[model samples]
Target: MARTTDGNPERLAYNDRVDRLRRKEYRMLKGTTYLDHAGTTLPATSLVTQFSHSLQTLLLANPHSASASAPNTSHRIVEETRLKVLKLFNASPEHFDIVFVANATAGIKLVLEAFSGHDEGFDYYYHRNAHTSLVGVREHAASSHCFASDAEVEQWLQDEHSFSGDANTDRPTLFAYPAQSNMNGRRLPLSWPAALRSTSQRLRTYSLLDVAALVSTSPLDLSDHAAAPDFTVMSFYKMFGFPNLGALIVRKSAAHVFDQRRYFGGGTTEMITCIGTQWVAKKEKRLTDRLEDGTGATHSILALHCAIDVHDMLYGGFSEISKHTGWLAKTLYERLASLKHANGRPVCQIYKDPAATYGDALTQGATVTFNISSSDGAWISSWKVGQLASSKNIHIRTGSLCNPAGMACALGLSSSDVQRAYASGFRCGQEADIREGIPFGMVRASFGAMSTLEDVSIFAKFVQDHFVGKGLLNVDDNDEKRVKSEEMRRSEQSSTPSFEKPGLRLRPVRQQFWAKFGACIPFRSRRPDVVSAH
Candidate 1:
């Protein structure tokens, strides 16, 4: 049984039950402790089995057949998966059009391409800490603006407020922002979409939400709001499953703007044409099939279907999963706050406001960001911690994590300042040259459906052991035997005869190989004449 910091046995046993269930539920990778669910998650065993079955039985069927009596089993599977995805987001079939693409980047590109012609007076806006794909979209749009906060975005959209009355509103504006940011795991308020809609209505602009991260934590319901966004994009892989599929759900009103023939060929058409001959477009079916250009990944789509089913079965539901993650996050934050180093210095500075309510805490999602402050005024990088943890079979990630702008804002540093500090040997949480700006980034720990109370406890204990310079946890008799065997090997090697001896030189062979492939090659030097040199 795993005990909490207070040493309460009752609480420990309860938590242990949860952990045991999680262990039995998830097919955890052998010899590795996973904590980077934000990057990707390990799929459940059911998903794998279902994926294999579907791939073997149905994936090879031709998408387009001339036979009128052809079976639509594959199409049925696709539709079922689409319905599951719609259910996950609480969206209706008509209002939300699900177009399956390769991945998140492809989805973003398709949406941007759909709105390519309306880039006249359009100015793209995103938070300073948005995903790189959004930044890339802004660059492609060529007329983009960035804001630090919600207030700044609202202020920018106002005509009578800032920059005088010359506020340009010629083209349809698109704001590509995350529902819950991947970096630092910060969940934007529910009011954010409504707020954007309210402001954009006055400015005659549109909004496109990137809800890739938020899908795992909560069900997105866009029905009630007076002002709704034009489109939203999400990825299935980030939550739990396959990597090659993504989804884009567009508002019904904005459906007509997507050109059917923009990027053509394959299953998107009814018939091909010869030179000067007219072609037929499949207009009778739904718009989703019209936008779907090629034969979809049947196996991956089925895998996603199984993934959702597994999520529902094991985690109970999205609400229960959220509760579990929230509990873990809150416990981790509180425990990290109370932990101290050997010299009585706090290991991490927890960020949650003490006065915030439970609802307010839920708004942040299940992610904890902290700074490890050391006693000698030095600080530890999350990447370094990740490396240390990996040596003990635990896995995590560090650095700005593709949100350089957000990292800059949160740490109060300029882009150049961050670059310079990183160029120096400065770790996270260390005070640096203020003139260059604030000098550290945040380290984030995120939770998923399979993560349990024991995982959190193990992490807390690991942190404590590292601070006090102790051995790793779960080091059993096998590890001791391995260490003993390694020591014996070293002793045997020491007693063995030296390689260097009279007339028994093995150095010449090594030298020959070394000369053939020198450590450093000179780019400017001419190639040796192999025949003449030999």
Candidate 2:
């Protein structure tokens, strides 16, 4: 039996089971630390196996065909998977209708397109930390508003309370926000969805919670029907690590919004005139049938069932996954935050609340975004760090990370400054264009259920050796006291927790993970604390 750090048999059995799954999993690319789980995950080994087994045993044809038994099988599978997805979110059939889409982007587009076809205009309010897909919804709105921070968002809603619109004459209003920020892994208030419905009586308020990032690490409880979002968009691949698929969950009351769909395809209509003049859409349109434009990604939908099964087997549930990954993120954050130069200047600047506790799942996810600085106080290039990490097979992400507003806030860039940079060729995926002294971006390292403490230690050791002075290993006086206190608190918290928490155990470094970086440079007794570029 594989043993945990504590040598507890129950924990050992749990780790052993996970280890077996990890060994069977073929998706883990060789020699990569894969610190970019926020981007995508490695599918479990059994996901593919289960999918193949289903293919071999069941006859699944196009779900649109009503006359054939094979189509019936396909239909049944699709419905079952839909329920599985709903159950995964703790959503009920009476409250939410699932619409299949290409991915989360497609899901958002569907809602935007349907809403934009309204005869009346709409007021759109979105968060600054929203993903690019959510940001695109502004184009479909009559008027758009943005809030840079949670405080700003709350204040805006509060100010709007006094203003009354003619409910009979005014257009509907929609609020869009990511449940969790994809850039820095900040978990926004889940209560925002229900609050919007009650925000104003004079306007029809609907909310879309983009759960693309949130579902990866934790469960989104739509079980509270009263508090659920009008629409929720998510990509399954982000959760299962394979088979790109997405869903748009529409509240039953909001299903009428999809009646505005201008175009119909394949199975979306009931009858058509012979002269291509008039068409009759299904009068009692099924929620999904109206929104799913054409033939679905059948194979991917089939794979989703297996993915959920594999996910549950591996991690028990999101709660366990959340606790484990939360521990890893806090550990990594604390280590990076505690680093300093000989002059006591922080070696890194983290773009998150410095006071976030280790086990707190409310404020953050398993993602850390930060920038390292030279002892001289000049910012080191995050792109360069990513490149170096890549050379060592430590796969991470860098640059603005597709959240322009979040990036702007983190880097203190003005709108004009961002526009100027964009005009000058600064963009996502072009991190190489970043010249030295540009003060461009921050590095991001995000973990998942699959990550281990050795991953954190290896990363810490790398930053320690390459980015700070050897003498800087000693914690400053103030930091020393803080570290001691944090340690005491962590010890107390972990002692009573039922699950085996990660990051509490120190293991031998995974030397192979850093082998390509060459032998570690000897620590000097005393040297200029400048971060070496070499």
Candidate 3:
């Protein structure tokens, strides 16, 4: 039996399971502490071993081969992998079909291509907090809206506001949003798809969910097909960290939306006449065959199978993995939240949902994003922090995170201000951050099922050893707090919620989680005179 860190049934089999997983399968993490699981988890040796064994013993070839001697297992493997992916998500094969793609971005493009085939191009609506992949879809829409808040989206769904031309006309519509924010691990409402379907019957709406980040730790429950999104996309590499493959899960009920896709590729067609007048007859039997443009990634798909076996063998199930990673996220959040300077200033600024708690699987994932600060409240360069952390062999992710809207929202950046900065010499990967004082990016420390308590402690200590106590301040005290311009101040006011903003929900960090850990990671001699901005 795996031991629990908190001596609770909910956290059972997590600590001991991952501790063993690290020593046996993940020997690469022995010397270094990797906290960038949000970017990609470390691929385990067992996964590679199983995959290598299959490659050495078996003959696999392209499924599209016309030769009779070409192994028949490739087709079987492709079909089995689809079933495996569907089984992992708890989606019924009767109602759902998986289409393999290069990555999540490619899946998104396929859906957009399908939507563009309509008589009138589809209207696109996406959450402002979405990843750049979702944000880029606006270019293909007949009309689009970047909804700033849930309230605005709900109102739009109510038919009170409309972005498409002639609201009365039945123009096809698609709403894209991430299951969890890639910038931070804030889990958005999973109920949005069912809610979109309940709106006025005069229009048609489809939901495109990007679950690339969500499935990293938790299982996506598609048990209720009626409530699931029309189309969902995710990368397998984000989950098991190998092969670099992704899939698009299409609800058969909503598969009609894809009939508009005009282009068909090699294996997708039944008959093609290029000599005479060009006429194409596509394979209409399966949605997967219709959209998958070229030969499938057979070896990568087999690797996914091996990954699933190793994942199941080690963590037991996604539920257990979820519980393990969630606890680590909450614990790490608490530790980073506890860090402070000698003069009572916080060492980090964590960005999270005020209404959501960390330990809850529904509200938050196993990722935490924030920027570091000086003792005098000056913004520390997030990229600089990443470099220093890398020096200590504590790997982490930093920068805009390919989330421009979330970056703008969190960093109090206005459209004009960011534009002006870019108009100047400011650019991505530049040493100088935005403006004269604003941070160039934010920092992220994410957890995986293989992550142990030692990794978290090492990371927290890395932040403490470098940023806490004395001699860390480089900027003048007067220049610490930068004066926000009028536009920037207004953006910040709208971006941040009021304390009394009705939904002020919080979860208490379990006492056992802290008391048990306090003995291992020691605090500095000088206690913080003031509280952190929790």
> Highest lDDT: which candidate?
3
Query: Judged by lDDT against the true structure, how good is candidate 3?
Result: 0.76
Q: What does candidate 3's lDDT look like per residue over 17-108, in tens digits? A: 67876898888887999998888887889899999999998789777885864448888888888998999999999999999998899999
Q: In order, what lDDT does every prediction score? A: 0.59, 0.71, 0.76
Q: Which stretches of candidate 3 lie over 4 Å from their true place?
A: 1-13, 69-71, 160-170, 471-532
Ranking by lDDT: 3, 2, 1
- Could you say which candidate leads in TM-score? 3
Q: After superposition, how far is residue 385 of candidate 2 from its true place, in Å?
A: 0.9
| lDDT per residue as tens, model 1, 1-534 | 255544545545545655666566564644456677777766777667766776776634554653543236667788899999887777777677788887777778887776665646345667664777676776555466666665665675553234223335565566778777777566665555566556535444556777777766656776653455677787888777554578888777667667523666567767667689766655436777777777777767778888888777666666656666667777777777677555565666543322223224345667776655454434454544554565566656555556656655554455555555556744332222222222254467777766766667777777766653222222346544553454355446665433443422111111100001001111111111110100
Error of 2 at 146 (Å): 0.7
Q: Please identify model 1 stretches exceeding 4 Å from their true place.
A: 5-18, 29-31, 68-71, 119-121, 156-167, 199-204, 225-227, 270-285, 342-344, 350-362, 419-441, 468-534
lDDT value, residue 468 of candidate 3: 75
Task: For residues 22-96, write the lDDT of model 2, one tens digit per residue.
Answer: 656744654567788888877876788898998899888888777879988888888899999999988999988
User: Which of the two, 1 or 2, has more TM-score?
Assistant: 2
